[model samples]
Structures are given as C-alpha cells and as structure tokens.
Target: MKKQTINQKIEIHASAEKVWQVMWNNDSYKKWAAAFMPGSHYVGDLKPGGRIQFLDPSNNGMESDVESVTKNQEVTFRHLFELEAGNAGKTLGDMREKFELVEKDDVTTLFVSSDMPEEYFEEMNTATTSALQIIKEMSEQ
Candidate 1:
C-alpha cells in the first residue's frame, strides 16, 4: 500500500539544546509513549540509522529501524514488522517521520510531519502532540 503522511507542529518553551538533550537521552521515552501503549522505551541510539520501538513492552516491542536521524533536527524511521497481520499480504512501505526544530527570538518550534498509513492517522496525531508536550515540559524542567 502507498504510504500516507500526517503533520503536526509544536512550540516548546525551551532551548533547542535542552530539547535535544532530553530527546537523545535514551532513557526517558517511557515517560511519554507509555501513555499510548502502557509501556514504551528508548530502544536505540538517537543518531541517524538508530532504531526504536513503541510497543506494549509486555510482549516484545514492534521494531522500526531508523532510516535517517539528525540530532536536535530531524529523525525518520521505517516500520520493520507488519503493523497488523493484514499488512503482511500487501506491499507495505516505510513510514517517515521528521522533527524539524527551528529557533526564533529565543523561542523554539518543533515541526513534525509523518508518512504513515491511514489507520495510524489518529493515533499518530494524538501521540505526536502528546510527545511534543512531554518533550517541551521535560526540556523546560
């Protein structure tokens, strides 16, 4: 199936470096994504080609290999496993998510955009906002 994209933007009340620190910390993802699946972890390095997963954490996490990552700038990854048993039969494609952080007048704005499937639209949108909020809060903290 052809991939679809979803987009959201967030403004963080923190500096770009502070946001980068928390984002690449590698041990704090659980505090955010857990709200989506009850268990989520920092599964890989924060650099380009690093891997990560957002899963139940009860069963093993569904894996997604990072396609490209740029510190405090952008990150994109692909879903390795089929999202559902149904995706196994089709020409499944990659989902690309980018986080573009821009600073102006001492304010930071995070622009998030994703290429994903329709079914994932709602969840990703909600999660994206929540994740940004958490990151903003954590960065300011």
Candidate 2:
C-alpha cells in the first residue's frame, strides 16, 4: 500500500522568521515539541544534510537527517532510527517530514507535512498539529 502524507498547519500572527525561530531554536523547540514528547530536544545543528539526534530528557528518542533548509521558508528531515540507552535500533520506517512557512501581510501560515507508514498516520497527525499549535502560541508572543 502506498503511504500517505500527514499534513498539519497553523496561522500565527508573527513574521515567518519568528515562526522559524520558535520551531528550531533549541529552547523554543523543546517547549513547543513537548506535545510530541515531553522535555524533547535535539543534539545537532539544523543545517542541510546534517544529522540531528532528537532526544527526550532521558536521552531516548530518534535521530533524523536534515534533508534541506531554506531560511524562514522551509526545512526537511528524514527519520533514521530510535535510540535506547545510547544504542541505535531499527529505523522508523521510510519517513520524511517537512516544515513550510509562508507569510502574507504579517500572518504566517506554517505547514508541516510528513510521509509515513499508514499505521502511524493518525497519531502523528495529531501530534504534529499539537506541536504547531504550541509553536503558534510561542511565535505570537
């Protein structure tokens, strides 16, 4: 069966740059990403093609490859695998996620899309939406 893309979006009353910062900046990332996994943070720069280790407070989570990045516009990442007690496990399937930001007249529409296996579609869709909502609240502050 062909996998479907899970898309989520939110409009924030802030500049695209501000929205981008809230989405990527470490501290802010942890705050907004709490919806996905509480106390989540990453260990790596978000540059294109870089490897980022996404971790919870106990250092258990997954890692992803930064596929592409466009300042204040878009960013893409591909899931690699899960880590437990510092050990890497099987991959999280073939999944890719993208975050796009479009600004018009002062409101920025942030769109997040992810392509993953069908079984995980609904849960991740809900999590992504919650994350975006938190990001919107943070950026509008």
Segments in model 2 whose C-alpha atoms lie over 4 Å from true places: 1-4
lDDT of each: 0.67, 0.87
Worst 10 residues of 2 by lDDT: 85-94
Best by TM-score: 2
The alpha-carbon root-mean-square deviation between model 2 and the true structure, to one decimal in Å, is 1.8
Evaluate model 2: give its TM-score: 0.90
* Per-model C-alpha RMSD: 3.4, 1.8
Model 1 error, position 33 (Å): 1.8
* lDDT per residue (tens digit) for residues 26-102 in model 2: 88999988988898889987899899998988889888999999999999999888788557976777778899999
List TM-score per model, in order.
Answer: 0.77, 0.90
Against the correct fold, how does model 1 do in TM-score?
0.77
**Stretches > 4 Å off in candidate 1:** 83-92
What's the C-alpha lDDT at position 4 in model 1? 65
Model 1, position 44, has a per-residue lDDT of 55
